[model samples]
Target: MIGSGIGAPEKYRKVVVEKLGYVTGLQLSLRENLFDAAQNFDDLAKVSSELRLLASCLIKFAKDLRLLSSGPEAGFPYRE
Candidate 1:
């Protein structure tokens, strides 16, 4: 039983390493998306539409945060 348990840590380490690789890939993809959004605004109408969509997303996120932090100890406590 002790010998069998010896491989558990190795297996867990392998899984963690694999997950870190996946997270790194996702981070790179997000960075690429940000770069594209920042640099590729050629059309004025498209830029206006994208800006409106971004504003709406930000507004919704703010509303969600407000709703979550309604009570004193309900959600995340942010300090300014």
Candidate 2:
């Protein structure tokens, strides 16, 4: 998606891939602790809320970029 959608260079793609791996590891760690009854539910909720905000921003940025690049001879000439 990053490559096709944003015309991301190889270096940028590598950075994105590394970040995604880090996020996946974090999610796995969170999942492992999610069932602990002693954990603070409010703090978990706040973390979830922040993740949602991050997702929203990423989606909006991708959508906006796609829109800006749409139409021939108007923006980026993304090859299909």
TM-score of each: 0.38, 0.43
Residue-by-residue lDDT tens digits, candidate 2, 2-56: 1142354657656665787797774321123323534546866999999999999
Task: Return the top candidate by TM-score.
Answer: 2
- TM-score of model 2 vs. true structure: 0.43
The local lDDT score (0 to 100) that residue 70 gets in candidate 2 is: 83
In model 1, the clashing pairs are none
lDDT of 1: 0.61
Instruction: Tell me the deviation in Å of residue 62 in model 1.
Output: 0.3
Please list the C-alpha lDDT of all candidates, in the order they appear. 0.61, 0.63
lDDT of predicted model 2: 0.63
| Alpha-carbon RMSD to native, per candidate | 17.6, 18.1
